[model samples]
Target: MTPYIQVVTTVADRTVAERLAAHLLEQRLAACVQITPCTSWYRWQGAIEQGEEMVCTVKSRRDLFPELCRAVRALHPYEVPEILASPVVDGGESYLHWLEQELRPAKED
Candidate 1:
């Protein structure tokens, strides 16, 4: 798998999603964040619920997942926010290069 990943999280509204996206970009934790309106249905507190939400798809390196999750949780209003990451197995070389350039440099151990 590639070192890149796409982190996804859902917020209650567009405002929250935009705030989260801006914060991630400002912190250099994400190369790009795409926000989309969505309808989510899930089980919460033993009850099935549905709502309108905004999905934030973040393009970032896998190594930054931990920090990214922490930042998201700090700003997210939900008691248990959804922070999921999926490996980017492949992508366009030019786009990947741009992604790397936009993100913070990887730290050395």
Candidate 2:
């Protein structure tokens, strides 16, 4: 798998989503964050529910997942925030390079 990953989370509204995105970008925790409106249906507290939400897709390195999760939890209003990561197995070379450049430098072992 590639060193890259995409983290996803949903917030109650566009404002909160934008704030979360900005925080991640400002902290260099994400190279890019794409926000989009979405309709969600899930079981919460043993009851079926539906809501309009904004999804934030964060592009960053896999190694940053832990820090990213912490950052999201800190700002997310939901008691159980959704923070999921999926590996980027492949991507356009130039685009990947740009993504890497935009993110913070990887820590040395």
Candidate 3:
């Protein structure tokens, strides 16, 4: 099993944020997701741009990152979504275990 980590991505709007979070959690791609509204300023097409955005902080296992990235790319509206991740070195063991279970795909007996 891969270690757990947090993945961060920003969406252009609140509706997209909600939808993406739902899709990730529903598909077991993420254990939890948080959405925060913020203002983004960056360079786009060689020009400075600013806009309101919703940042999605996703938590899941490292092994699922590739799958999660692919999933995000498929549905994301931006030409490039900020898909970044950081490792979780330590945490409450019980909570970590719960995260693992929460993101597990259901099995058929």
Candidate 4:
């Protein structure tokens, strides 16, 4: 398994996405979270639905995926929030290293 990954999830609005992102970063569950505005179409409760959504892309180590999911779920408003993780097959060495560093546990002072 790749050591790096990106977790993807969608929220009803930008504000929710921002909060989740901030929480994830503060908890050290993700190195960085990027929010994007987009339109999504899906079937929910047997009905077709379309709406504006903010996509959150969380970058971090693969080992932190579970914690990241849990954090997102906690802040997410939807009962069933979309949480998906994908491996980063390739990335700049400097960027990958930075990501790992950001997710590292803070040393005791």
Tens-digit lDDT string for candidate 2 (1-109): 6899999999999999999999999999999999999999999999999999999999999988999999999999999999999999999999999999999999999
For candidate 4, the 10 contiguous residues with the lowest summed lDDT are 100-109
**TM-score against native, each model:** 0.97, 0.98, 0.91, 0.92
* Candidate 1 C-alpha lDDT tens digits along 2-101: 7999999999999999999999999999999999999999999999999999999999998999999999999999999999999999999999999999
Query: Regarding TM-score, does 2 or 4 come out ahead?
Result: 2
lDDT accuracy of residue 109 in candidate 1: 93
On a 0 to 1 TM-score scale, where does candidate 2 land against the true structure? Answer: 0.98
lDDT of 3 by residue, 62-100 (tens): 878889999999889999889999999889889988998
lDDT of 2: 0.95
Q: Could you tell me which residue pairs clash in candidate 2? A: none
Work out candidate 4's RMSD over C-alphas.
3.0
Considering every candidate listed, which one attains the maximal lDDT? 1
Best by TM-score: 2
Report the candidate with higher TM-score, 1 versus 3: 1
Candidate lDDT scores, in order, read 0.96, 0.95, 0.89, 0.88
> What is candidate 3's CA lDDT for residue 55?
92
